[model samples]
Target: MTIKEKADEILYKTGLYEELKTYGEPHPIGSYRMDMMVYNDLDIDILNNSMTLEKLHTLTNYILKTFRPTWYEAREEVNDEGKTVWFHGFHAILMDELWNFDLWFFDRETITKAEAYCDTITTRCHQNPTLKTTITTIKKDLLTKGLYHYDKYTSMDVYHAVLTENITTTQAFLKTHPLTTY
Candidate 1:
C-alpha cells in the first residue's frame, strides 16, 4: 500500500481521519518534498482516563503505521552531562492542537524523526494525565525559553547554528522541535 493509503487506513481505524485534500503542491525544502498530511484533534477530556493504556496503544499503533517513520531515531542514551534519558533525545513541535501528523518531508529526514517523536509523545500523553498536562507546560516553557523563535524556520535555515555546536539536539529541538539538525 502507498504511504498515504497506509496513513489513511490507520486514521480511519481511529475514527479521526478527516482528510484535508486542500494541501496543494509540495513545498521545496532541501532534498525533499514537504506536505501536511492528516490533521486531527483528539479531545483529551472526552477520552476516559481509566482506559488510557488502551487508547495510547491504539494511538501509537496508528502513528507507527500511518506515518511509517523508517528512520525514527532511538531515544538518546545520555545527556551532555552523562545523565540517562529516554524522551529527551529529540523534540516534537506539534502544530496547533491537532494530533494529526501535519508535517512531513522526504528530503530532510529530521522532519520524519520529529513526527515520530511527536507521535510517541502524543501516545504517552494519552496514557497518563500528567503527560497531557506537561504538553501545555512544555509549550509555555518554549515561549519563556525563547524556543518559539526557531519555530518558523527550518533545519536548512539554521544549518550553521547546528553545525557549530551552538545548539545541541535537545536545544535544537527546543528551538523549533525538529527531530534532527542538518
Candidate 2:
C-alpha cells in the first residue's frame, strides 16, 4: 500500500482518524504525558496555575494507563544556551507494535486558526503536485540527519520555505538555515 494509505490504516486502527475527522485537529500542549486537547474547548485554564497543570497531569496519566500502551518514551535536548529541556510530550507504541504515535494534551481556547492553517497546507499540496514530492524528500533527508520531528520543523514550514525562498533541495534548505539541527 501507499504511505498515505498505510498512515490512514494506522490512524483508523488507533481511532485518531475518526476523532480528528469528527472534532478537527487537536492542539498540542507540552508536558509529561501528551494530553488530548479535549479540554481546550472547555473553560478550564490549562496554563493558569500549578493546580491546572496537576489536574491535566492526572487526567493524562489516567488516559495513558487506560490505553495500556506497549511502551512509551520521552526525549530531552539542550538548547543553544546550554539548558536541558525535556521535549514536551511522550511517544507511545499504543495497542501494538505497529501503532506508534505521540500523545500531547493541553488547553487552548481555539483551534480554528490552526485548523485553517492545516486546510491551507492541504489545499496548497493539492494544487502543487510537485510540492508533495519535495516535502517527502526533505523529510526523508531530515530523518537521515536525525532531525525529523514535529518540534524540530514541520512539512508546512518546509513547503513555505520551498515556495517563498526557492529552495529546490534539502541541501539548499540546509544552506538557507545553517543554524538548524539538520
Candidate 3:
C-alpha cells in the first residue's frame, strides 16, 4: 500500500481520520497534506481549561507512542503582526517504502485561520478551473522533481504565486522566492 493509504489506515483506526474529515478540511502544505481541524467556540471554551490541555497533551503522547512514526516533534512558533502571537503544534512524520506522511496538530485559532485560507483557495479554484489545473500540474511536476519539500515551499505558496504574481512555473517561483530565509 502507498504511504498515504497506510497513514489513513492508522488514522482511521485511531478515529482521528473521520473526526478531522467531519470537522475540518484538507490542506496541501508543502510536500504534505493535512486536515486543518478547527475547534468550535464551545470546544475552544472546553479546551481553555488547564486540565483539558494536559489531557490533550497526554492524548498526543499516546498517538505518538501508538503510531511509532519515524519522528514526532512538538513545535511553537511566534508570529508578530504589530503584536506578538504564539502558536503551538506538533507534527509526526511516517515513512514508508515509497513516500512520507506528515500529520499536524494545531491550536483552535490557528486551525481556524488555516481553514479560512484553504476556503479562499478553494473558492479561487472553483472560480477558475484553469487555475486549479495549473496548480495540480505544478504540484505533480514538483513531486516528480523531488522539489516539493515542506521546509522549502508548499503547493499553497505555488498557487498564490501563480494566481497573484503571474509566476506560472515552479522554477520561476523557486527562483524568486527561494525557501523562506528564516
Best by lDDT: 3
Writing each residue's lDDT as its tens digit, candidate 2 over 85-120 gives: 332233344323333345322223223444455556
Tens digit per residue, CA lDDT, model 3, 12-104: 675655543432343333222322211100011111212234544664566566555454453333355332222223344434332233333
Model 3, residue 123: what's the lDDT?
74
Q: Which stretches of candidate 3 lie over 4 Å from their true place?
A: 1-10, 17-53, 75-108, 175-182
1 or 2: which has the higher TM-score? 2
lDDT of 1 by residue, 139-182 (tens): 34444555533454333333333333334343444555453546
TM-score of each: 0.25, 0.55, 0.58
How many steric clashes between backbone atoms does each model show?
2, 5, 1
Weakest 10 consecutive residues, lDDT, candidate 2?
36-45
Candidate 2: deviation at residue 109, Å? 6.7
lDDT value, residue 137 of candidate 2: 76
Give the distance in Å from residue 31's predicted Cα in candidate 2 to where it truly belongs: 21
Q: Highest TM-score: which candidate?
A: 3
Ordering by TM-score: 3, 2, 1
